[model samples]
Target: MAPRSAVLLATRNVLYVSIAGDLIVAAIKVGAAAYTGGSAMWSEAVHSLVDSSNSILLLYGVHRAKRTPDQEHPFGYGREIYFWSFVVAVQVFALGAGVALVEGVTHVLHPTPIAFAEVNYIVLGLSALFDGATWLIALRGFRRGAGDSDLFQAMRASKDPPSFMVVFEDSAALIGLVIALVGSYLSIRLDLPILDGVASILISLVLALTAVFLARETKGLLIGESADPAIVMSLLRIAREMEGVAHANGILTVHLAPRQIAVALSLEFSDELQTPALEIKVSELEQRLRALHPEVIAVFVKPQTALGYAEAVERRRGKTRQIVFHTPSPPGPA
Candidate 1:
């Protein structure tokens, strides 16, 4: 197993913070739901409960991902985090969103009146306080590698699931709270009990949408999304600048874990370089690449001339790539 480090454990502190706040909030919400019989409050309690459980799963995923590479899985357990994250997404949709919707529909059909509206108001206030603080903590590093990209773009580009998953959940929670507040207030003030159920339904929709978003993001990682474009570009520059290299064809990278990446480089080295000398150069090259990006756990070097590399890339373009991706256009002349 790779030694544990802060890098390997990205967003761990965030998960810890999330679990603590969610546990406290879940308890408070559960109590309030029992006291008030508000459908929205019950939904909120369930949401908090699911959030707490998801945080535990994420933490466990992070732990399991740190296990050493073995004969069964040579790339280490890094991508196990992706698998668990996907499971979290499934849980959100199945448990969190599904339960909220079920509760909403049940109350909508039954139209149960919420008692002691003040209790819900007080609980909402406290829930917001707790969720808001933790949301802010999760948001702190959201833009770390996003550069000048907008929020949605940054999220799409993010390679680390946990780095932003909590944000989605917390943001949905806060929105659902607002909706619940509105639903409850109108239901009580207007003596329309169904509005509270409507609010719960709305919260359910929010969670459902959040789950879809999370699942989509996580699916990409689980299947293998590339490292950040900037990371790939930087490593390509490093390869091109290395001694004895004539051209750096390109590099391929996949995130084995949030902080773990596997890289392969195709480079055209000087023809004068003999096999033994080329071996030393490749070793030094790997050292330089690792020094720059410790996340790059494995580097496979492929030697080929520029023209040969281009031809090889072109020949395999339609044959193999089409199996994975469908390009809009065939290759054009250089």
Candidate 2:
């Protein structure tokens, strides 16, 4: 199978597992909340339901992002994943956090005694088991790409949403479960039902923070974060090694999708090379680049003199810090 197809399959599988687990957990949580009249349990139910919906949206985003490039969108619809990811963040903040917060406040004001706190304990424990399993699945997928980095670093470096998003959701769910368990235990032990509502508020806070963080990361991608700096440097190195190439000026890149990148390279070719030779050199360079990095979907090459390349850089001066090779002096008399 193709690399992109494999990526889609893996992502879809993760989403499917999460959606199934959350639906089953949510159903049980709702029943427990209704039976026990526990605010935290109710909040957890909402959280699980929201998680299932978010995973579905992510699955859809993955599919939409797979659309083939056309005239209107020459780079394809890869950024669709980022856009939908942002929308998921909004839903978490608005629907998930908002509902939990409101429920928490109402419960605190009413201060009703929780019934059968033991039921909440059972439900939370089971939910944790389910959520923990799914979390491990997502983490394993993320770790495949993360190398030696920690989970937090991996999330920030990850270009794909479903990979890290599920991690974030399941992490919050697990933490929220612990808070519910503690709150349920304390509320019954201390005869303070308001503690249950406070626990719900904490869960809401966790969800809110997760949403904010997810939004910031997805926003960077939506605004077109460049591919890894390493990838950029490697592409320049490849172009510099070409036989007809005099100087590899620099490379420009943007991630069209997690695995899809569009690259533009500037090169100074040897003066004696005619049009036919230059075309062959360009084709050879592109083939080499794609062979080494299959993720680079398109490469745009520009033929420029050293002076022209310098002038182009000068025009864009101060826009952002740039890493570029010093222009080489013209070749000595042959």
Strongest candidate by TM-score: 2
Which whole-number lDDT from 0 to 100 does residue 64 have in model 1?
91
Residue lDDT tens for model 1, 1-334: 4433754444788899999999999999999999999999999999999999999998998889878999999999988888988999999999988999999999999998899999999999999999999998888757654567787878888877877888889999999899989999999999999999999999999999999999999999999999988899999999999989998997889999887889988999999999999999999999999998988889999998876676678776753323345669977899
Each prediction's total of clashing residue pairs, residues at least 3 apart in sequence or on different chains, is 1, 0
- What is the total number of backbone clashes in candidate 2? 0
TM-score of each: 0.91, 0.93
Off by over 4 Å in 1: 1-4, 8-10, 143-149, 320-334
lDDT of each: 0.89, 0.91
Model 2 Cα displacement at 36 (Å)? 1.2
C-alpha lDDT of residue 184 in model 2: 83
